[model samples]
Target chain A: MNIGIVGLGLIGGSLGLELYTHRQQTQAQISNNPSASPSPSYRILGISLEQKICDIAVKRGVVDEASVDLSLMSQADIIFICTPIAAIAPTVAKLIPYLQPHTILTDVGSVKKPIVENCSALWPNFVGGHPMAGNTQTGINAAQHHLFVNKPYVITPTANTPLESIKIVESIVDLLQAKIYHCQPEEHDRAVAWISHLPVIVSGSLIASLRQEDNPDVALLAHYFASSGFRDTSRVGGGNPELGLMMAKYNRDALLRSLQSYRQTLDKITTYIEQEDWQTLEKQLHQNHSDRLKFNL
Target chain B: MNIGIVGLGLIGGSLGLELYTHRQQTQAQISNNPSASPSPSYRILGISLEQKICDIAVKRGVVDEASVDLSLMSQADIIFICTPIAAIAPTVAKLIPYLQPHTILTDVGSVKKPIVENCSALWPNFVGGHPMAGNTQTGINAAQHHLFVNKPYVITPTANTPLESIKIVESIVDLLQAKIYHCQPEEHDRAVAWISHLPVIVSGSLIASLRQEDNPDVALLAHYFASSGFRDTSRVGGGNPELGLMMAKYNRDALLRSLQSYRQTLDKITTYIEQEDWQTLEKQLHQNHSDRLKFNL
Candidate 1:
């Protein structure tokens, strides 16, 4: 089955490489622009996603051919949108005319609800996709053929979404060898707000707060003392502020709601601290610790 | 040099193993609790620290001898107080009478001001030491011979402190193969307030807010999608609430100052987000990104 990937950034570029690689071992005809060929009309990323992607593809040997046109979408059985959240809608709107009638469409957006709404509004055939994979590093240059190894890829389909389309999207995710999970669009948004978005704001606030201190020496020590644990907690919080702010804004209500709920949890601990209730505090941490261990991540 | 370690918890137990391993290599005449047998200590940690420490020391051959008695202070050239914050002062008070005339004393408490204060008030021959090594995984069971490897060990000495005592503590840390950092007591607290304590409160607040959400499904999803970054940011925040509270209380004035400063920074970001100042927000985040990279963390 032909799969057309647009954007060719981190997510899109990696997907293209993976699908191209999969075709090598299987009985599939993968069409991608050649690595070295400078397409006269195609817009490659940065210098040339057209050239670099094909070179990587050839080096990794993923696709027989790669290109930069919606004509690629015309031959594809499915199309995956791996662009940024803002670009997803416009890109889909632009490609709808050329998209095959029954082709399944998906995305790798961190936020899902808005993307689903915009895609469904723009195109008759669209299935909401949210792949939960990231590194602090970004861009097509940082893309690895195995970037999504063993990561969760969520597909959120509504009542209007056809079951066949859902399966086709799932099949593509399967080809990428990622763990597939299904959830509602709103559920996806709410989940990300808690795990992904909220952490960024919290961490940014924490680190940003440090910048206010007058003691540069202690600041240096604090940074030195800041180890793996500090890095972990501040990881999401210290992310791209625009992306962080956008997540909070797009999922504002949900995030604010989550924040409210989180405050209550924190307040309980806060009260326990004020009252000096060490016993309960330990119990609460134990619960959080236990809950944390339940997830594979 | 004989090093007497009081309170065989995470820091003490780990130090025991480290000292033992280092002494063996350096062929130093280390005076410790000879009765303190060495073992894997993991099993001991699961039971009780007192027993776990004893067992681990004996099984691992960490000490020539071990004792629970305060007199252990009299024999040692240096004493390292590796206990919780609450115990540091009282332990120092008790050990002062028994310590040798020139004994070098230090601690492994998270906070330094109180320890330094207590040392000054209760004893003259003491220096404040904070080995900046820890893991979320606590207990004697988690003790390792090399837990302090490549970690910072901060030495906070007051105006009254003896430089020789500082040198002794630094030597111990160096022997443990840890990096050394020196800062004043207040400076250390402020630094921790920003990077360490701030993250804890911020992360706890974030996690606590999410727990309050009405939709448990969303909460569960958020928990699932949370990766190493989220966990790191929230690490200190999710720690023992009593410890967190005590930290705030002991360093309340400094912490409050840090918190207020942090609030201001966060307020700036919030205002930008609320104003829909995308360009400003991007620039702010870019600055934050650059500022964060300047630290060694």
Candidate 2:
């Protein structure tokens, strides 16, 4: 079996490394055991637009082979398009001709509904997969082995998607050592908007608000006084502007609803502070605390 | 010289341990060097309403002596009233009769303006001090030495505050190995409102809004989908409700203004998303990212 990974950034490079390791281990295990099936041996082929990334992926042993040509992916039984949200559709379109009759294609985009809608219509084996793992740093340099260990990897499959395609992607997720979650494309998009994309907007807006402080002295003092709370709350907001924009663009309606819902929650909290209703405010805060505790993830 | 710490909570207990260590180190240095001044020898006397706390503090070598009686504070040349914000003024009022004429009094509270105004009016030697160091855990068991090391310690002094009192507190801050920033009580409150308290409100509201999601599937899926982004952004919001309430109560006006500013920022971002203005959204996010990078702390 030949595995293909395109766009060797953080996610793609990490996936290549993990898959290669898993494939090698499986082959060794099959060799050691007489009853084990040795027919389905896997090899990883990595593709990147930049020759530097392809060279690094090969030098680092992230894949068995890497090239700058899309045609190299024609031999791949399965391909993971690990590009940014805005580029996923275009990248898939360019690779369609390289896909074999038995080829199954998946993606590691953050947003799913739009990608799934566009890709599943274009190819029978296109499965929308979102590996919910990332880092502060980007590119091949930031990639490492076991980056997706124990992280949630959501596969948003439409009704038209073949069961064989999902099963193939499930095996890929298993190779990466990540937990698998299955949902419709729309449901996955909305769920992520609440837990992932919504945080970006709210966190970003907070720093933006702080930037509006006209008093230079207050701003300076704020810098000195800011501690763990501000650092944590502002982390996602201040990360990856292009990614944030893509999340907003692709998941527009759900993100807007989240922002509006968040606005209402803020207004209610503000009113409690304004009216000096300490009891209600404390009760509401207690509720929030408990609600957060319900989700350990 | 003697140092007194009232209330054996996280800050108070940690202060006791650190001060005791510093005092012993200085005494050792003076004894070892014949030329070093030995006149300003210091001892730590810890007072707690609970006799159990006093006994533990002494047993743990957190202080030179421990007592339940306020009269023991008479020997305290400098006293740190490290109690809850609501209890600070009342605790100070009770400690006044035991205070010597040369004594310097301060408290470690998050919101400084209200406490400073109340305590400074009642005590001639009162100085407002806020040590910007804490943990999620509370009480004496959570306390450890070096908690204040390299942390910001804000000293807010008014026009009426004596230079001697400010000097005394500054020395204590030095002993804790903390950097001190001098500001008015109101300025400290306003600055923290932006950097610290505002984050609590926004973080808490994000979780609260997620709790309000009517669709049970979406809510359940959100929990599964939630990752580091949600965890980080919601950390302070799900923290101690009483502390959150106290911050809201003590710094009402400033917090209200921060909430308003945050609301406007959220609205503008929401409009950008609703209008599908990806350029403006990306620009705003880039601005937030750079703004956050300006302050390393």
Candidate 3:
């Protein structure tokens, strides 16, 4: 099946590579203009949306092909909307006129509810998806052919989302050799908020806390001493700040709720420390130890 | 030079195995008696400390005959006080009479200030040392000869600390094939508070937050969805909680100060989110991105 990928950045470019590796040719549409460089803004485009360069690369056999028109997506059997959260709505709105009734639509967004809510009605064929795989690198240059190998590809389907379309999307994800899991749109947001969104804030807070120290030596030393544990925790936080802020904005209620729950947990543990209740603290540690054993990772 | 290890738990036992592999013998004292377990209600007899274990083991041909010791660590060229943070102070107090002036004393506690402060005045032969190497496994059974290989062995020496004693401890750490660095008590505490202690709390907070969810399905799904990043970040939190709590409690002032600093940083970023100040958020992310780049990890 022919796949149409929008944006051609990390998510987009990676998806293109994965699709091609699966022996499916992809028709990619990069929306930015190459000759007219935009301001170095917070948009994902600054990192990935290279239309002209991508077009040249595609012409030179870097990719199968590239286009600037949304109509090109009309002929695609499956279309993956791999754009930023803000751009997803507009892109979906524009593509609605040309999106085939039977075409399977999916996205690689971290937050699923907003996009799914906004586009599910616009395109009855849409199935909200998030490939739970990413690296620190950005842009098409950072895209790897096997980046999605063995990663979880979450497919969030609403009551209105056609089962056949969900299956088609799953098949595409399977073709990339990614495992697929099913969840509701709201569930997807809450899950990502707990694991992905909260970590960013926590890690960012860690970095910011060190920055408050007046002594540059201490600040520098703290940074130097940060090990793999600190890096992993802070990985998502050191990502695009604008993207982080946007994620918090888009999933504000869920993120806030998660943060509130998290604050209570922190307070409880802190109180235990204050009271010198080592027994209760040990129980809490046991709970985490038992809980963490379930995941293969 | 023969070494005496007081406790045969994770740190102590690991040290024993490592010492044995290097063909250097160490006398170990472990409490084999069930009574001397962590709980006060448990029995307290014959809890073979590393010193005792190594003594018997060496005599029984479990190790070289050259390694043999009991109460008097006077024969020990150096004594490694490898025990829990809570046990470090009192144990050292009890063992001080046995420590000769030339016997270099060191430990592997996560917190160093209290340890250094407690022993510096009490034991003239003491030198505060923390081998920042560890694994999830504990006890003598988990001991490996190479546990300390390539890891940082932080040695905190006071202003009044003798230079010869410091060199002796450094040479011992070098024999273990670990990197050695020297810092003041406060500096060591603050550095560990940022890298080791702080990550534990943040990770525990994350685990506790996820556990608070009343929805069983979401909790189960979260367990399934937990990734390598979560595992790495939460490793310290899921560790021995009593030990974690003690580290936080012993280093309470530094940890509390760091936590307050962390919360304030989080508040600033949360405010940015509440107000949708994406520009300021972006700048902070860039700053963090740059700051993170400075770290070796």
Candidates 1 and 2 compared: the better one by DockQ is 2
| Model 3 chain A lowest lDDT segment of ten | A39-48
Any runs in candidate 2 off by more than 4 Å, and if so which? none
Q: All predictions: root-mean-square deviation over Cα?
A: 7.3, 2.0, 10.5
Q: How do the residues B1-297 of candidate 3 rate in per-residue lDDT, one tens digit apiece? A: 666666666676666555554442221121444443242111111124545665554443223432233454655667777778888888778876766666667788878888998887777667888887777787655666677777778888888888998887786577679877777778778877787777778788888788888877666656657776566666666767666767777888777777777777877887777677778877888888777666777
Candidate 2 clashes between residue pairs 3 or more apart in a chain or in different chains: none
Model 1, stretches more than 4 Å misplaced? Answer: A28-64, A100-103, A136-149, A240-242, A245-250, A260-284, B1-3, B13-59, B100-104, B136-150, B171-174, B238-253
Q: Give a tens-digit lDDT track for model 1, residues A76-154.
A: 6667777778888888887777777776677788788888988898886898987777676776666777777788888
* Candidate number with greatest lDDT: 2
* lDDT: worst 10-residue window of model 1 chain A: A39-48
C-alpha local distance difference test of each model: 0.69, 0.89, 0.71
Ranking by DockQ: 2, 1, 3
Give the lDDT of residue A128 in candidate 3.
92
* TM-score of chain B taken alone, every candidate: 0.84, 0.96, 0.81
DockQ score of the complex predicted as candidate 3: 0.36
lDDT, residue B172, candidate 2: 74
Cα distance off (Å), candidate 2, residue B194: 1.2
